[model samples]
Target: MKAAEPPVPGLRQPGERPAPGPADGVSVPGVATPSSTGSTPSPAGAGIRGKRNAGALLPYLLIAPAFVAIAAVFVWPLIKTVIMSFQDVGRRELWTGDPAPWVGFEQFTNILGDGEFWDVVWRTLLFMVACVVATMGIGLFLAQAMQRMTNWVRLALTGALVAAWSLPLLVATSIFRWFADSDYGVVNMVLTKYLGLDFRGHNWWLDPKQGFLMIGAVVVWGAIPFVAITLYAALTQVPKELEEAAALDGAGAAGVFRYVTWPVIKPVFQMVATLSVIWDFNVFGQVFLMRGNKPEPEYNLLGLYSYEKAFESNSFSQGAAISLITVLLLSGVAVYYLRQLLKIGEVE
Candidate 1:
């Protein structure tokens, strides 16, 4: 420019730009330079990401068929039953192709208004409570006893429980019926002859109170195996170290159980109790078979009453309403237990 300034070191000449070097293409160390053709970087990570996503979804996809089958088989039938409860479904509508008229809540209202319905509800509630209490008590006792038993004894007890649990409902009911026979039954013989009691030739099912008790006994007996097995499994999960620590701290056996063991198994105990209540409340086969489908007024539970109303009395909608009520009641128990289970999960 003015007489051309002396050439300075590291300075470019006028109208001249710096040349590209090996360091010019490198924005950071260890990073590759852009391609000569100016193409974008290959998405190599995308394929790996896609593979991971597929793996994550595979378990859900595998279980989808099972969920679909259950929805089709059980859920569909249950929904149909609920819809039929709101309709006036009779023999013609059930057997023939006649359309069932929509009755709304008429069946529900009628059943609610009936004195007999309330009676059966009370009886069922009482029986369910009794059976649940008995089953839980016996089951807990057996579980604790099994925990302390020798291997052979535990094996024998477990085998007996499994065998009892495997017995068919009808078979167990029949066995109970034989045991309760008035003339030559084992119960009366044990009471009158062995125990010197005055129960000989006593017809156990003749009275409503006694009949309910007898049915409850059978329910408790059958339910104990399931409850005991479940409780035992839960008990196995509890560390023996906790019990020992509690004992070393001068806690008695009861104190140790109440403080150390109960907390660990409380969720399982609640679940077992809830299930027992539902099973006892909805028991049909045992009561129906034991009473020969002609249960006395005193012995009529909701299940038996519903069957009688639908089949014998031919009031299909009303029977369905009763069954729906039973379902709702059982659902309440299920919901409560599910909440408890969720709480346990959250705590864990």
Candidate 2:
């Protein structure tokens, strides 16, 4: 309603201010001006921000292929195994083009109802616990000893440990089998001739309970080197000054280890223990090769039991169910350890 304002020089419109020029030393609210070099100033931090964003995505891109491969190789098979467990997958359906009929949880129920299965489960648990305890105990002792040994002695011990660790599972099993031979084994000979215990011609693998102990011994022997080396490596990271200080404070060897060294290496020990539990619990090659073509029911671990059910007995569904149970058990241990590690991280 008011009279129109007079046109203003350098104004785009009547209400607008004069457009800023190079000599004016004024800036537009949302526009960038050229610098003294005559090049336009870039949007604030645009190049740096772009580089930061690319860097953030680089790690994910690098790992994507590995993730894809794992998903295809391991995850896919696991999913199929789980699906097969819920279906009736026997020789007919496996060979024929027939669809496997779903019998949800029937195989699991059958396994649960079988007394023999329960017995095997108990034995497997006992075997796993025994091997874990024995392996950890012997490994800890050897690790501590190695830390104090002279260089030459340490070198020899390390070589022996590496040899044991490097032995393949099947090869180690064969070696132990030879050692347990009733007629010619060195073990029986040592007991009979050297120790005067009359263990000659004792068929160690005949009795199921005794066979479990024998095979467990083999597994423990093979497992010890890894655990020992890992613990020793962790021990080396603990500062010698701390141990000396503890010793200076009137702590004996045991007290120094318990107070000063244990805390630093406990995490490594726990990690090794968890791995031992997993490996021991799933051990199949040793027991299978030890029994040699005809594995006894008594010596059947969860791993061997599952194998026998699927391949030998042709009970694929039941075998898959057993494998799932084993997976669940191992997953529980893994989850517990993961939570513990997270707690330690938070505390740190």
Candidate 3:
């Protein structure tokens, strides 16, 4: 057959006619080219592979900075703290004590057995619940009111809320502390003069019930603004058509809010409540500054207890132990709720 046609490159004899010629878009006698898409397929395959690799690396690239920062700041410190928690700060030879000596879990055991620690734990739990419930209730009401306001009023109200949120945490704490001051505070004066109550000269921090209530009030006030703003944004996303349809069906105001409004805005409520719980549990500066970081058995939360252990008593290990416990507790809450939050839009 014409001297056997010298076998075509990358192909069998002439009957095979090679696979295809990409440029001609047909089978050829010698050239072996991909038939699909009338082009050489290898380059296209390489391009697709490169695109897949980039896609796989994109997420990591986005988060790389955060990971690096965390490792440098938080993760490293956390590891060091955990290590220090296992050491005894007291047994060291003071100036030459090598920082700390290994003491196992003695610090944790001591904290666990301390009655004050347990008391603080109970207070923190109760405080967290009260603050979350109060914040959610007020926030939902404010959000609904915001939704009904005119554009000017909405803008004004939103600005006011943002001011409250943007106020420095320490500044807010100072303002509330001054307001709650028994002798000079305007609040006590109002109570004593207007309400005819003997709130003046009262050490509110000395009384567990009143102290906890005062802290909760300040927390709820500070937190409601944030929650309201968040919920208001979510409320805007709710369809007006759905609300109108409900109204057309003779649904009352209460019915529309209870059914149509609440469900649509429920995600924001859940998110705010979850965050509120964490903030409430970690409340320190407000309560501490109010009492000057002094430990009052009645008002002490776990945070305050940890502060006392670290600074007041110089028990670094105990403080670290309490911190570890609080972190674990908060982490558990985050893990539980984050799973719920990630599933927010899944349900119809």
Number of the predicted model whose lDDT against the real structure is largest: 2
Reference-based lDDT, residue 190, model 3: 90
Q: Encode model 3's per-residue lDDT on 227-299: one tens digit a residue.
A: 9988988898889999999999999999998899888887767777888888999998778776665647677
Candidate 2 — which pairs collide?
A: none
**Per-residue accuracy of model 1 over 127-237 as CA lDDT, tens digit each:** 888888999999999999999999999999999999999898888888888899999888999999889899878998878777777777778888899999999999998
Q: Which stretches of candidate 3 lie over 4 Å from their true place?
A: 1-62, 91-99, 198-200, 345-348
Those runs of model 1 whose alpha carbons end farther than 4 Å from true positions after fitting are 1-57
TM-score of each: 0.83, 0.84, 0.79
What local distance difference test score does each model get?
Answer: 0.87, 0.88, 0.82
True lDDT of residue 206, candidate 1:
71
User: Which candidate achieves the best TM-score against the true structure?
Assistant: 2
Total clashes for model 1: 0
- Per-residue lDDT of 79-149 in model 2, one digit per residue for the tens? 98999999989899999968999999899999989998888888888899999999999999999899889
Residue 12, candidate 2: Cα error in Å is: 25
Candidate 1: give the clashing pairs. none
